[model samples]
Target: MSQVFDYIVVGGGSGGCVIAGRLSEDPNLTVCALEAGGRGDGTLVNTPTGAVAMMPTRINNWAFDTAPQAGLGGRTGYQPRGKTLGGSSAINAMVYIRGHRSDYDGWAALGNEGWAWDDVLPYFRLSEHNERFDDAWHGRDGPLWVSDLRTGNPFHARYREAALQAGLPLTDDFNGAQQEGIGIYQVTQKHGERWSAARAYLLPHLGRRDNLTVETHAQVLRIVFDGTRAVGVEVKQHGEVRTLRVRREVVLAAGALQTPQLLMLSGIGPARELERLGIHARLDLPGVGRNLQDHPDFIFGYRARSTDTMGVSLRGGLRMLLELARFRRERRGMLTSNFAEGGGFLKTRPELDAPDIQLHFVVALVDDHARRFHLGHGLSCHVCLLRPRSRGSVTLRSANPLDAPRIDPAFFADARDLEDMVAGFKLTRRLMQAPALARWITRDMFTAHVNTDDQIRDVLRQRTDTVYHPVGTCRMGHDALAVVDPQLRVRGVQGLRIVDASVMPTLIGGNTNAPTIMIAEKAVDLIRGVSRVAAQPHNDAQAEPHVEPHANYAPQARTVEARHAIA
Candidate 1:
């Protein structure tokens, strides 16, 4: 007989870990988590600086490449996803941002009930154990550890000085009452180590909870359905095929790219596409793989005169060795750096309800997602349009379950996105040119001598790509195009739910990790049929309304012309 679990959580990523961890807490419920990748608890995964090593190698990342983007001058973009127990959170920069409150309200406005800023704020607090903050805006007793960067990089201060000089305020917390400002980021680290979702939720509970069973390297091939109800999952592990029966539900937490692909492979997608792939259509859900969204990012690389920022050199190599020694001995120093150490949210236009552009200050030259290497040392900053209008899709390549999905982010497909990218590029350039940083920059390595509207547009078309945040492939809403309902239950299917970034009706304005975890935290309640109204009392002041523009910070008139010209 096949092993039966009350809840079968597929893909042991951020959301999967949370679901399995929380559901098994009931003691009466038996939960099984299936991970396609390894345990992901190695030094390379736990060290903050180890992201550089993993980003380039296929060590713990899917590192999938996208179909050539039509809007990006026919360039195939790189898409690196975490293929480990914690999923992308195990391999990401570990920046802990919950996005703007308006981002959630926007989802609610789009017909997703119980997803408003007020309803979701408590969930964000539920999973966070912030080390530096203890207030109504933050929680101090959650499982996930959120702390300050242990690396005492002097350049972080310099970046803040540059931001202030460029007219951005220094905010103490991006997840606090106000999010529009420049500041040092709080990372998902615990005592100078990367605290991935696996570490935060899964690892500690392993073996202790008899009801929870985690199986690593178990690749789910397809969802086995009985009529319209999902009953089991076919999995391949160690060259052996097996089936695991689910008594209650099968949660899909395979992320935006793979979740949709899995749904299509399981015969639940556009009927025409399924027939073309030679698969019998189980459900003709046109929206199963549509509505792809990601932040289109552009990087500004500057050759630096100082070695404070990470670079390639003999002296830098020696510093790295010493830093490794420091890390191994005391668990602190440069090795704890998350690379994109300093950045914040900003509004290109003052009248906007929230920040439209988000910045990521990098201590190393990140060219083409680090695929292209530079010989010497430098610093780079990433500018991404937070609220992009362009939408794309994730489609199946073939019937083969192991085949990579066709990802078409279609970045800059909407012309307004191009205008925002140009504005973001200009804003980032201005911030980098501030006196504090200008003194160290030897030259602009990428965007130099580019000033005209056409020049800016050309640069944006060539250089812009993803900042690794992708969502909405399995969008949740009440509309016809929505694959999942607001409660996260897959429409037209029984005993199935999507509990990952894929269910986001609209992409959040900042990092997706915090929000993804929050989704899982809230999902357990939905699954348990608990009333959120009586859960806990929270301060409404935490979800403050958008601030009016200050007289001194009004957007320049030239920006209007630039937007029109680009359009």
Candidate 2:
């Protein structure tokens, strides 16, 4: 007999971990979490500074690459997502950001009810246990621990000083009232180790409960449907095929890229596209894989004349050994830092409602313009458009679940996207030229002294890539195209929900790991009926949008555009 669970959560990533942890709290409910990756038991994965190398390696990363994007100088972008228990959060830079409040309110305005800044702030607060700010903006008692960077490099200080000199105010808290300014980033670290979602949400409750079954290295192929209702999930575990029955719901917590691909593989996508691939259409969801969004980033690298470059000193044979010795003895020094530490949000043009660009300053000299660079004394700064005007999609390569999806970020697809990136590059250059950093920095490492806007635009096109924040594939909206309602339940499928970054109606303007975890927390309430669905606020009142089995399916049309206009 196939084993049954009250809920089956796929992809034990950041959101999956949170959702499984919270849902299993009820003793009556049995939750099974299926993770495609191995056990989260690697030393490098837990170390704060160790993520940089481990991220690119196959140990903890998926290391997926995109199809050649014509807009990006015809280059194939490297897309690195986590293939571990904690998902990308396990391998991410661990930066903690909630993005602009307006970013959330914009979703509510887009018909994602109960998702405004006011409604979601409590969930963000509920999931966070910030070490620094214990106020209205931040939470003190939560599962995730967010702390300020303890070790600030000289370059970080210089970066902030230069930003202030360039007229950008030095705000202490980017998560505070105003986000327009430069400041040190707050990381999701504790005791100088990465406190990933697995560590915070899953590990503690692993042995405590028998009702919660976590199957690692279990790659789910597709959701098993009885007519239009998702009743179970089929997974391949250690070369053995297994079907886990779900008594209540099947939650797809796979990240943006994989969620839609899984849906399409199950024949729940555009009828035409699925038919072309010989897939029988379960439901014609045109937007299943549409509305893909990502943050396009441009890097500015320069060589330092002085010995102040931390990358050079750390990469040195003797210095690295010394740092490792110190790190092993006591968790401190360069080994304790994530290196890409200092950066913040700022308005490129004044009179804007929100910051237009986000910056990330690193202590390493990265060239190739790729990750393959001599760790000599060099500095790199990355600037990305906070809200991109462009969009893309994820299509299935085949019906096989083992095959990776075709990811088309279509970076710089829109001319407006190119313009935003170019403006961001110019702003970053101005910050680098400020006296504080200019006194220490000398030659341009990557661009090598380019002064023209077109030259900068070229540099933007050549070096730009995703910071790995992808969302909106299974978008939540009040329109026909919406895959899921505001409560995260699938529109055309019963007992199926998506609780990850994929369900975000609009991409948040900052790091997405934190918000992903918050979504899972909010999702728990919805599943338990602690909170009502968007349109159906009354008890026993079902939202008409909730699709049942054997129903005539017709997706609603939606306008794919951010309500918060980028001025």
- List residue ranges in candidate 2 displaced over 4 A: 305-315, 368-370, 531-567
Q: Name the lDDT of candidate 1.
A: 0.88
Error of 2 at 152 (Å): 3.9
- How far residue 377's Cα lies from its native spot in candidate 2, in Å, is 1.7
In the range 1-567, model 1's lDDT, one tens digit per residue, is: 239999999988999999999899899999999999999899999999889988877989999999999899999999999999999999999999999988888898999988988888889888999887777677778899998888888887788777666766666678887788777888999999999999999988988999999999999999999999999899999999999999999999999999999999999989999999899999999998899999999999988877677888988888889998999898888899999998888888767888899999998888988878886778999999998999999999899999999999999899999998887787788889999999988878888979888999998888988999999999998878899999999999999999999999888999999999999999999999984433344555554434333222323421222121111
- Report lDDT per candidate: 0.88, 0.81
Q: Which prediction has the highest lDDT against the true structure?
A: 1
Candidate 2, residues 380-432, lDDT tens digits: the string is: 88889888978989999888889989999889889898987777777777788
Using alpha carbons, what is the TM-score of model 1? Answer: 0.94
